[model samples]
Target chain A: MTPQLEILITVVIVSSACAALGVFLILRKMAMMTDAISHTILLGIVIAFFITKSLTSPFLIIGAACMGVFTVYLTEMLKRTRLMAEDSAIGIVFPFLFSIAIILITKYAGNTHLDVDSVLLGELVFVPFDRLVVFGRDIGAKSLYVMGTILLINMLFIAVFYKELKLATFDAALASVLGFSPVFIHYALMGLVSITAVGAFESVGSILVIAFMIGPPVTAYMLTDQLKKMLILSILIGIVNAIVGYWISAILDVSIAGSIATIIGITYLFAFIFAPKRGILAMIHLRRVQQIEYAVKSLLFHLYNHEGTDIEKEESNRHSIYKHLHWDKRFLERVLKKAARRDYLSVNKEYLKLTPEGRKYAIKSYEVL
Target chain B: MMFLESLLRDYTLQIVALGSVILGAVSGILGSFAVLRKQSLLGDAVSHAALPGIAFVFLLTGVKKTEMLLLGALISGLIGAFIIISIDRYTRIKFDSALGLILSSFFGLGLVLLTYIQKRPNANQAGLETFIFGQASTLLKRDVYIMIALGGIILLVVGLFWKELKLFCFDCEFGKSIGFSDTKINLILSSITVLAIIIGLQSVGVILMSALLISPGVAARQWTDKLSCMVILASVFGMVSGVVGTLISSSVAHMPTGPVIVMVISVIMFFSLLFATKRGILWRYIKTRRDSRDINECKILINLYESALNHEEVRHAHKTTMLKPIKSLHYLRDKGYIRRDYLNTWVITDLGMEKARNSIDKNRGERV
Candidate 1:
């Protein structure tokens, strides 16, 4: 396979893994925690690198994972103190840890190969340079294996604990009573997220990792109601994002991670505005139709209530009805026109009179409303 | 005295420290309100959102004028803040997801633009990326003046609308009920927060700026429950960290100021959480332990007295195994509430009986 395909595959694998685990994160209202973890894991990787003094050491991944979990633990501990709000706790802890890491890099590790830019804005174009050679045999890109393992781990975790995770996410108290420790599942899920973050860190950087994690999941959320379908949809969206984002970045000669993040944002914006049922435009359209329907029903009711009454003329006049109903004159006219078109009311001598069909319609609306 | 003399002699140090102090003080004041209103993450989103603005401005002007770039940032940050508000308010998306989405995507766009500008033949040294991890030691005197002016304006706005802001932070529904427009008040609050963030960004950078906004507010919260005191304490914390962080970074080789300031403020937050007088973990733990100990002693004495009354005997021996609060038993003996009668038993003294009766009467009275 060519290098471009290899890079694309790396991105897709990373996105799929992130999006898969991200479903549970967003459902648990932890999108921001993922943000906190992604940034803080840099600190962990730095510390681990210092210990092992090797970028390729497995300890870096382990340290990143540990630090990700530690971020959640510290935020929760601070929140449990009830001295500050939850988001404030996250805002405090991650920056503190990340700052320490940055400071360490700037002051002590400046001479090392580790560059802060790579930590923030990872360059996937360099993927072809780092080939995995096993026993002097040429293999694939190293990111392929790392991200693939993370992807498999995420899938296995979701598959093995599907029911438990579902129960725990929706209702933790009941899940706890039913013999599944939600706390354990929670920590385990966070651990996987951190691991995925570490694996993807090289390919997409820390900040863009959030785009992969949350973008596809939220977009899927906009498109689907079923959890299984949402998870599958997010994975597909992640794949598409990786492909489209890579192409855009390649064409523009810009940052691939940035392009991918922008694509994710645009995709979610599209879903937000144009999804069939839940999209903003669709809801707005539904509200407009509902408004006209309700207004016509109001006209029917008003005409039916005053039918053959002493004040029927005074109440049923279109110009006067707007005032009586506290609606705009133009709106009352629109409602009147709608009622007449439906044969629910007849206008004669500038006063509305309910038709025989109109009387029945008013009674039906009364029952339904 | 030597340090003070050095501070006076060093022109760049004076400028950077002064800028950091102003940035810290204003952000701290506004951050207290943000923390109370649960908008701590808003500053993070706004700061990141400002990046595309700066880069875009530089792309257009081809010159890195701080004021022009900051103006672009202000516009961009406001738009980002508005989008976050709209997403959270109109859609089913929660506040946190909206924040994370906006910050990352905007930062990414900024990166794309920065890289784009760098690739241009005439782009020259964009140096635009430095805003990500701001170098406080490079702050100019003009930047310090801008920070002071903006800082003063923020302070004045906060003072002028103190009552409305307090109402908005603690009780928005009540404020709405009393005829303050919720949207208007929210606009004022977010505007000040955005300005404060803009002022701090050049010193602390985008990523750590949130810490500057949140840690001081949270640290001050541990010290006091009142909003006025909390805001005052928070600004003081911010200034101290700013000054100290600057001093330390200036002394150390290859040290960037933003992270050091973040580290210093975090230490302050950690200590505040640990040792604050009212809400600190240590204080609460001690209070709980002492309360439990008192309750245990009261129960042991009350048990001896009740058993004596039941047996119709002045001296009733109780098993040491049954009354298992060994430490409380020793304390009761020391307090003259009970006495050792046998190897495995103890009896309530007259003093213990009277005390238990009075305590039981008081409990009954309170319940009634």
Candidate 2:
């Protein structure tokens, strides 16, 4: 396979794994925790590297996962003290841990292949250079194999505990009462997050890791209500993001991860403005429709209440109605025109009259109010 | 002694040190307000958002001047802040989710711009990347001057609006009910925070700038309950971390100044968590232990008094049955709450009985 395909596969795999686990994170309002984990896991990898003396050692994943959980634990601990709120606790703990890792890298690993730069500003192009081997046969990019396995682990975890995870995420108190431990599931999920973060760290960089983890799930969430659909849609979004992001980076001659992050942001912006039900555009339309309907009802009711009175004849005319309602000429013309179009009222040269159907509607609206 | 003398003699080091200290103090002060308002991560979003502005200004003007770059940074940071406010106000997305979205998206744009600039010949984009991870060593005397001026302005604004900010942080609705213009105060506070972050961008960089902003407040919070004291203490902590981090990084080979400063602040936070006077873990632990011991002492004294009243002969010795009660008896005896009679009978003294009754009454009162 071409290195481009390999890089694309690696990107897809990383994106899927992050999005899959990210569903739970976003649902649990733990999205920012992923940001915190993505960063603090750097410290775990650094510590594990010091202990194992090898970059590819499984210990790195374990160490990073442990650090991820540790980050959550510390954040929670600080929060439990009642002194620190959620954001402050996370803001304080992860940066401190991340800086320690960065300092350690600059101090001890400056001459090594692993440096702070690689960790922060990830290199996807270099990913294809490191190939995985099995029994002396070349397989594919090392990142591909690593991320593939992590993806499988994520899938297996999500599948095996799908019901429990859903129950716990939506209602932890009930889940715990029913024998599903929310705390355990939360940690297990965070552990998986750490592993995914570690796997994607070198390939995508930390910020992009966050962008992928949160962007797809959140975007998918905006477009759907069903969990199953959200999961599938988020995975699809990830795949599309990976491909489009890769091409964009290739064309622009820029950072692939940065391109992907930008694409994710663009996707979210699209959903934000254009999602059918909850989208900003739809919301604006809904409000405007309701406003116009309300104005029509008020106009009909006014005409219905004063029909057959001598003063009503003058008050119900277009000009007098405009003055009575104190509406602008254009607005008055529009609402009156709408009322006529809807057959709720008839407009003669100088007088307006409510139809039988319009009388019923006016009485109904007045009674409801 | 040598390090101190050299620090004074070397103009470059002195400038860097001074710059860091001012950066620390300003960020620390504003951070306290941000943390209190639960906008701590806003610092993160704003800093990352500044990168695009920096890149944009550099591209448009083709200059790497610190003042111009910082001004660009301030604009983008405020823009990011505005986006966060809009997303939160107009959508179902929570504040945290909105913050993360703006942070990542803006940062991505900045990275693209940065990479694009890197490819251009003669762009002199050598120092641009440092804003991501920060390179304090490259800070020049002029950059220090900019930091000093900005820092002074931020501190002055915070001081001038101290009461208004305090009301704003603790109770926005109350401020509004009293006819204070919440929007004006919010704008001033946010602008000051942006300026503070822009100053720190050169030394601490975007990645860890949030750390410098928040850790000082976190540390100072452990020591005080009052807002004024917390802000002052946070500033002091921030200055200490900045100075210490710079000194250590300079002394040690290959140590990056920003992270080292973060580590120093973290250490201070760690110590404060354990040992701060009011809210420290040690103080709480000690209080609980002492309270339990006093309760135990009271229990044993009450038990001994009951035994004394029940005994037919005052000389008859009543041996304690339980291990805990025996230990408590020994303590009571030491404090003259109990006496050993001729036959080795433990007798409750007048003082002991009085103490026992007080303890019993207190326990009963608490339960009710």
Candidate 3:
């Protein structure tokens, strides 16, 4: 296969894995923790490289996963201390680790091919060039295999423990009484998150890794209330972002990771504005239209149901009534036109008459109002 | 020691250290309010959000003065914060989601702009990259004076509004009920936070400055419960980290100062997490162990009572046999809760009887 096809396949696989595990992270409010893991993984990979003396060593994934777990452990430890909240602990721990990584890279690895920039921001275009070989036969990109395996692992774990994870995530205290170990579920979910981060970082870089993990899941959450629907939507969103973001970057000659992140952001914005139930714009429009409809019906009903005056004079002197009601003139005219179209009122040179159907409708509205 | 003295003698190093001290103290004072309000992450988000602002200013004016760039940064940072607050107020999205959205977008925009600027032919754009990860070694005497003046003004304003800030942070509704305008207080607090970020940006940069703000406050929180003392202790911690990080970075060749300062602050936070008396990991561990032991002892006492009631000869179960269980009974007796008779049997003393009755009463009362 061509290198472009290989890169596209690799992006799809890695993004799918990230999106799959991202659902749990977003639900648990651990998006920033993924950001922390992405940064701290650099320190782990660097240290592992120093020990193994090979960038391709399997220890790289193990070391990075260990550091990811350590990040969560430290966060929990700090939170239990009642001194720092979760966010502050994350803010403190990851940067120090990242700094150490940078310091090491500058001091010892500056001349080496392995540097901070490469580890932190992997080159997606060059991913296909790093081929994996089996018994002297060339296989596809190495990142594809790694990410695919992690994705399979994630799927199996989620399938087997779906009920337990759902219960624990929604309510941990209740889960504990039901004989489910919340801590066990938490650690298992975090472990999956760590492995996914390590795998995706190799192809998509750290910054885009967060966007893949958080953006799709959060957008999916906004679009659906059902967990199963959310998962499906998240995967679909992830795949679409990968394909469209890659094409956009290729056409526009921009950074691949930045383009992908921007696409995810745009998709999220779209969901925020257009989702049927929760969309902000939809709700605002619905409220305004309802208000306008109510105002028109109320004006027509009052004109038809006057108790002490002739309806003709009242309709002719609409402006005098408008002064008392303090309603806008344009609004009054629009309501009058709507009433005439509905056969509720007929307007002629500022005089009006109501039909029998109009009188009945007016009485119903008057009683309801 | 002599090498340290020689290192401190360098004018550039001295100036950077002094400037970092001022920056650290201001951040500490403002961050106390941020942490109390559960808006600690706001500092991080706003600082990252300032990147686009700085880049836009540079793009438009071709100016690189610290004051002009920071002014643009403050405006953009405030805009970012406003967006975050508005999203939180208007949408169903939680504060965390809004924070993530603003942080990523603003920082991404900044990065795009910075990359564009790098491709241009402007030599002055060289130090602009330092704002990502700061380098304090380049600070001059003028920067030091500016930091001191800014730090002093922030501290003075914070001092004057200390009581109002406390009321606002702990309970805004109550503050409003008592005739305080929560909106005005919030404006004051946020302005101080923005100023603190601007001053510290020159020293610790954007990404790591939030760490500087929050870590010291966290450490101080472990040490004290009072807000006033916590603020002072946090300032001291921040100052110490700044001084040490600056001194070390200057002594070592090619060491960036921002990360070192963050590392130093993290170390203090680590220590506080483990060792603080009022609220620390070690204390909680000890307290939990002690409580567990007390629970086990109560369980054993109740077990003995049940077993004694099962005896056939003693109608009221006033005595027990001497077995391994009796060993614990003897131990309790030595602690002045039980008595041993000449017949090698255990019996409850008056104090022991009263204690058992009280335990039963308390347990039943709790259940009800």
Candidate 4:
């Protein structure tokens, strides 16, 4: 396979893996925690590297993954302290840890190919060079195998504990009462998120890692409400993002990871503005339609209330009804026109009267509301 | 003394340190309000969002003017915030999803612009990456002045609107009930908070600047419940961290000032979390432990007293086997409230009986 194929596969595997766990993370309201984990794990990788003195050592992955879990642990500890809010706890802890890692790199490891720049703003251009050779055969990029395994592990964990995870994620109290430990499930899922971050950020950078992790799942969430469908949609979106981002970067000669993140943003914006049922335009249209319907009903109700009353002339006059309802005159007129068009009301001289159909509609709306 | 003399003498150190101090203090004062309103993560989002603005300015003007770049940053940050608000208000999508999405996507666009600039043949783009992982040693005198001016303006705005801001932060519904426009006040406070985050973006980098905006307030809140005191304390903590971080990083060979300052403020926050008097983890733990032990001893004492009432004597000996052992009974014994009559029996004294009556009444939750 060409280097281009290798890079594409790496991004696809990483995106899907991150998105797989992201569904659970966003559901648990831990989006920012993943942000914190992505940064703080740098410190873990740095310290682990200092000990092992090798970038390819599995210990580095273990150490970084542990640090990701440690980030969650510290944030939770600070939150349990109750001195600050949850986001403050995250905002405080990760930077502190990441800064120390950064300080170590700049001060001591400056000459060791371990600068802050490359770790944070990852470079996927170098993926082809780091080939994994088995028995003198150049198989593929190392990231391909690593991220692929992580993706498989994510799917397996989610699949094996599907029942427990679903119960725990939606209703932890019930899960615990039913002899399944939600806290145990919570930490295990976090551990998977950590391992995935360890693998993914090496290619996509940390910030874009957040995009890949959260963007696809959230976009999927916009389209569907079912968990099974959300997971499948998330992976599908991740694959599309990887390919489109790759094409943009290739055409423009820009950062591939960055272009992917930008693409993710554009896709989400498109969905947010034009999704079938939940799109912004659709919602605005729905509100407008509902408003006109509501206005017609209220007009009918108002006319029905004033029929045969001593103040009917003042209260039920078509031109003066806006003052009583506190609605705009133009809006009232529009509603009146719509009502007359629909045969819900008619004008007798200058006063408004509800027809039989309008009376029935008004009573039904009152009962339904 | 030597460091202070050098700090006074070294022009670059003086400028960077001064800039750090102002950025730190301003962020702290505004951060108290941010944390109070639970908008602590807004700093992270806004700072990250400011990147594209900075990049866009550099791309257009081909100059790295701090003022122009910051103007771009301010514009884009506002746009990003507007997008976040619209997405949150209009869609079923969660606020955090919107926040994470906009920040990362904007930063990504900024990265694209930056790489596009890097590919261009321009020496003027030398220190542009410093905004990502800020290099304080590179701060110019003019940059420090800009920091001071912006910091001063923010402080003034915070002061002029302190009353309305306090009400909005604490009780927006009550403020609205009494006829203050909650939306307008919220907009003003949030804009200034964004300004604070923007000013620090040049010195602390995009990712870690949120720490500067959030840490001091969190630390100050541990010590004081009053907003005024919390703001004051936060500024002091911010300034101290800023100055000390500058000093430490200057002494080191290749230390980046941003992360070091983040480390210092974090240390301060950790200390506050652990040791502050009123709400510190240590004090809260001690109070809980003492109260729990009190409840345990009171239960045993009440048991012994109630049993004594069934008998003729006010102080009756009871066998130890029937009751679970209370470890703090030694506390009662030391106070001469209860005594061990034999190896297996215990008796309540008159003092113990009176204490048990009080404990029962207290546990009953009301009294005459």
- What digit string (tens of lDDT, one per residue) describes model 2 on residues A1-369? 999899999999999999888888888888788889988888999999999889888898899989999999999998988777899999989899998898888889777677777776689999989988899999888989889999999999999999999999999999999998999999999889988998899999887888888889888988899999999999999889989999999999998988888898889889888999878898899988888899999888778778887789778877768788777888888888788888888888898888988898899888999
* Number of the predicted model whose TM-score against the real structure is largest: 4
- DockQ score for model 3: 0.28
Provide the TM-score for each candidate, comma-separated: 0.94, 0.88, 0.79, 0.95
Off by over 4 Å in 4: B175-183, B318-330, B333-354, B365-368
Model 4: lDDT to the true structure? 0.86
Off by over 4 Å in 1: A292-317, A339-369, B314-322, B333-355, B365-368
Candidate 2 runs further than 4 Å off: A285-369, B176-187, B298-319, B322-324, B331-368
Q: What's the residue-level lDDT of B49 in candidate 4?
A: 85
Query: Would you list the rank order by TM-score, best first?
Result: 4, 1, 2, 3
Candidate 2 - CAPRI tier? Answer: medium
Clashes of each: 0, 1, 0, 0
Worst 10 residues of 2 chain A by lDDT: A112-121
Query: Native contacts recovered, in order, as a fraction for each?
Result: 0.78, 0.59, 0.25, 0.73
Q: Score the docking of each candidate (DockQ).
A: 0.73, 0.54, 0.28, 0.73
lDDT by residue (tens digit), candidate 4, A1-369: 888988888888888898889999888888888889888889999999999998889999999999999999989988876777888888888888998999888787877877677666789998888888999998889888998899999999999999999899899999999999998998999999888988877887887788888889888988898999999998899889989988999988888878888899999898888887888888889999999988888888888888898998999987788999999999998898899998988787788888898888888888898
lDDT of each: 0.89, 0.87, 0.78, 0.86
The digit string of per-residue lDDT tens for model 3 on B246-267 reads: 8877778767788888888889
Best by lDDT: 1
User: Model 2: how far is B110 from its true place, Å?
Assistant: 1.4
lDDT by residue for model 4 (B1-368), tens = 87798798988899989989998899899989988987788788888888889989999999988899999988888888888777777887776777888888888888888888888876479888888877778788998888888888899999999999999888988999999987677667767877887778778888888899899999999999899999999999999999989988897778888988999999998899888996998989999999988877877888889898989976568887754565767777888878988777789998998898887877677754
TM-score of chain A in every predicted structure: 0.96, 0.91, 0.80, 0.97
